[model samples]
Target: MRKIVYLLFLGIWAVIGPLHAQTVKSDSVFLKLQQAFMAKSVGLLEPVLSNDFSVGVYNSPIAKYMLQNIVSHFAVDSMKLKAVERVSGKNSVLFIVYPHGEPAITTRAWLNDSHKLLYVDLFDQLCGLNRYKVSTLQATIPIEVKDGSIYLIATINDSQKPLRFLFDTGADGMAMRKSLADSLGLRVAREQNTSVVGGNMQIQVSTGNTIHFDKFAVNNQSVAIFEHVREGTAGIIGINLAYQYIVKVDFDKMIMQLYSMGNYNEEDKGGTTLSIKNGKGILELPLNLKVGQKEVTGNFIFDTGAGYYVIGFGDFVKRNELLSSGFKPYFSSTTVSMGVSSPTFTGNFEKMTVGAIDLRNVPGTLKKYREGDERATIEDGSFGVKTISRFNFTINLAEKTIHLTPNQRFNTPIDFMLGDKMFSFNERGQLAVLVDITAEQLFKQGDVVLSINDIESETLKKDPARILKLQAMPSGSKLSFKVLRDGQVVTISA
Candidate 1:
């Protein structure tokens, strides 16, 4: 699908189309901007996007000096515009750029009615829009699924220690947990605090002169290190890896394949292709979901980093009357997200359907969009790994399709249980129990849970990621936990 609004992470420039030429030379502006990007020269880029500029999702504007300092470290090449169309008004133009083998990028430029250059919205690609060079022939790497998230186990920097990263499309480049970064004593390049649409958080961006993934034996990769991640996962490996290789994620056999660019073929694909559009880094898919008897179709963000199966928007669900009248609510601890922290909670979906595939009593979580936050309104919902892992799904960003085939795991039931009440993290960094637990309690409101099923509480304090692993067990599965109540260790079985 075509879009005009853009993200700041990707590069951007404005060249007015013939749609409106009341003021300036359109061709000259485009040629200059295009030449500047190919040369990787900030001096040329500065004058084009000079004066006031802002990041895509947030309103925070940075001066040209700061933007110049940031782009000075980039290595860019093979840049060319693929498509452009005037939108919003004659002044706003949306263009698609094809950077050699990299994912196709969408950018937007706003101009004055007279067609004078205003500014462009660019997404943050640290390498400054370079295509990753394909190196290997064909390699199929084994993948593991835990708590509904796919993990790619790899050895970094030739170290014998294995690194686990959540296979994520929601991230720009890649991220390393600060704990691992400090433990490995990685050299830091730069750190910056960023303001996103939802809330404010700190992003510690790091660069490596040469870091090797001994398995793939890759080097000179740029990685970002964040302050926090879900427990049991070190960090995230963003979808940018697709730029260098043809990535195949098989949910059927629980494996992932990375084939060298020239080694991949069209015969390897089958089933219905899921259409996706990337205005920024997030891949949005067309989801025609059936909630109870009502069917609603909307575009859902493809978030492999998230664990839920299908998170419906509260307004959408309520309008469709998905839940039975006054269905009892069960609170679930799921998000570590800077956004959607205050989402209104509701009950689960008894059944759902994706294409011809029917899912029974599927486990899910619904998010009530936060007020005044544009990020929450970006999409109608999010389809996470939990729902996707049951199908053999292959994502081809180059072709812009997510292929899906129902696997043997498709009909398998999802066994999920949260106690009568629930626990989640509030803004104060304290646990919020949604229901009254003191009356008929297994655990109290303020009790710090030491562990769930022997997993430590260190990471659970940030999000309930570690505790969610046990949700896939059979209905008869037993749940055991250890908690700290009033400075004493207490064991309980549920």
Candidate 2:
């Protein structure tokens, strides 16, 4: 019995000894981090940081150089480390820091197997204070409505020239073209593989940046770099802005207002307020769609990045047999995203309902999935800006609610394929016919349009608003198109 007890004691010590040593090392690293902050020196952190060390809010990791830049701007004269606590899993440690005249900050750190600092998550520490926070109670920014989308002007870093950004509710964070990032000399913090509308692609990200617009500024911003974006725009201002502020868009006044969270009252807004589901930065709402006599209900993303009314995923459309259930499709085209294009069909739904609002003769697009393709499970479809812009809506992401009031364009008829054909810009900026299902086959794919409705193609290309106006013409409206096909100019009337 004595021998057995001695052996058990040795076994216990064997396990405890390494754990205790790890704890001591972790504590030492934590202390060093605190010291680095106090001294405002990045060199002190170098000894403890891992080769792949990154620091940022939860799930938003920036490179070490970004943290160094941020630290260089810190005024930590009145800051002190309050406590250090060891968390349960993955050699995690929490640091409680107290700054003079500010709220206490709690930072979480993860140590690697070699006891080097792997990642330090400052989400709890900076989420409410400096990162993406607006100093004023409210800010009013002018908005431009073009091609059924909203555009706002902003300046990146220290650039003085105003850059137009699309206010996209579908994007997870801010995204800009790689050329723009290169022009601004933004440093690449990391690379990540991300899934987009059509497919997946690897993206480059920059962190710890600032964005300024009008009278407001956002600090510690993270921007994803893309290969290209829409013409005449810088990039995208994503849903992160809505997460930080109460976004109210007034289409009639052509303005967007950003109200501090919890500062705007819904009752005063006087609109139909409805709850929304926020999952992984995507906001969704339940929608009921009617096709012929069948009714299908599903949750759809509230996406301002989509320029059309609605886009149904393959899973939902196939499950509900939307194509065969007395539904009429007028034209077929291709939808492109991130340089990947997929075939699509467009038509009108009988009716669609969202909360208390009802829309009749709603237009929707459905993707044509290839065989053996994986179906989406997260969302049924997405509601686009064309339908959403009809309402002057206020979205409060903190409260998970949206207040919507109908605007003047509420009763406007939904736009459809004007002449039983679809058009898109080709590589050389020429308007080419994309789809034509007319009985006469007046237009063929790749036909370069020379003129439409007496408007020159070059003039139409210069002013896209003219194309939209032409496309929005009511049903039974006639149009004439002149195109170059088979090396010959041909005029067709519909």
Candidate 3:
């Protein structure tokens, strides 16, 4: 009995030993690190840091430059050492940092396996770094509209079959549908915390050796894989373009042009130029709005991935205070990659502006996330494609500038129910259902919707451009559907 009790005690201690060592001297060690960073004295931190420290995100030279740049600008106000081994790896400590005037930061410090300081992980800084390369001086690509969204057709590797990809400005990394990736036997590079349209998740990141365009190609690019992708799209070409070229989108003409950094000239681009702040591919600009009795301005992500017009965070929306009059619940959406969504509240603001492009009575939502939720986006809010598609825009990658020219559709009211559901064309060449992102209950996950507003699914499949435009059309604030559920035909108005 005595021997067994002693062995049990040893087992318990074995488990707790590493846990305790991970946090021991964490406060004093991080304090010294912060002090040394401000002093710019490599010698001061030599005792705590490993002799061979490596930077993870970029090449050595650029990573060192980025590191020093951050050290130089770090606020000397306060430093708090926190344990987050799960995020930063074993024996990690981080500061709950608030950059003096900039956005809140999530940074982690690294320790070697021997419990010596290895390096620091500045997630925000690393994510914002753009070393993207483009080989083309100028190129033009045709675009097709489907379900009220713009899509680009391209090839994977040397394959003859063309796959459709969304030209999304808001996505940080390029992403593909898991089903497509599985069918192609693509490699998943890693799985980590990542952001989606209006939420965040631990997503599977994949890599494609080559993504070939007509005259250009991106080599060794990484893409995230989502469980749920809208039917017809194989993946999305995200903000990766921002690192390499200037992109001009003309929806009316159904054309897209890419210009190399040196070849593109923003001076000739005439429109309302908005100076956007960016880190990684995420873009945020000053958004001015008028609530009931007060006017406010805040930085919001200019996100094209989001389907809604606007979605704000808790504090940001509270300050704007558009909910005093009790705004109604709009559409709530979530991808299968991520389950249920955060509660969303909706209302209209008197006026909203991104630079000089103005819109009146714009519908917006507040996505509610608990404080300090890792799923919470770093930005106070996001601006979606619904409002942005109304403009002809030019995004200059090298300069971090966006020019917007209002189109006639700019005056069109934001839709209350911009319904987007999961679907795929069946082997029999008919549109089949997968899931619905909206809150309304219309059909089960596998039910096949034969038609919308009397338009035949077979005809729309043959000509998807027409279906895209009609999908966005409002049917008296509800949809009339002809669905085949369990091999039985049912007509329902939802």
**For model 2, what is the C-alpha lDDT against the true structure?**
0.74
Q: How displaced is residue 274 in candidate 2, in Å?
A: 1.7
lDDT measured at residue 390 in model 2 versus the true structure, 0 to 100: 78
The C-alpha TM-scores of every prediction are: 0.54, 0.61, 0.57
Please state every model's RMSD to the true fold in angstroms: 14.7, 14.7, 19.4
Candidate with maximal lDDT:
2
What C-alpha lDDT do the candidate models reach, one value each? 0.57, 0.74, 0.64
TM-score of 3: 0.57
lDDT (Cα, tens digit) per residue for candidate 1, span 357-444: 5665555666544444443355566777777766677665544566777666554434334555445432233333434433556666
Clashes of 2: 0
Q: Lowest-lDDT window of 10 residues in candidate 1?
A: 51-60
Better of 1 and 3 by lDDT: 3
- Model 1 spans with C-alpha error above 4 angstroms: 1-137, 193-198, 209-213, 266-270, 290-296, 312-328, 332-334, 338-346, 350-361, 375-377, 416-494
lDDT of 3 by residue, 182-273 (tens): 88777888899876534567778877557777767867788788886655688888777766567888776777888765334443345688
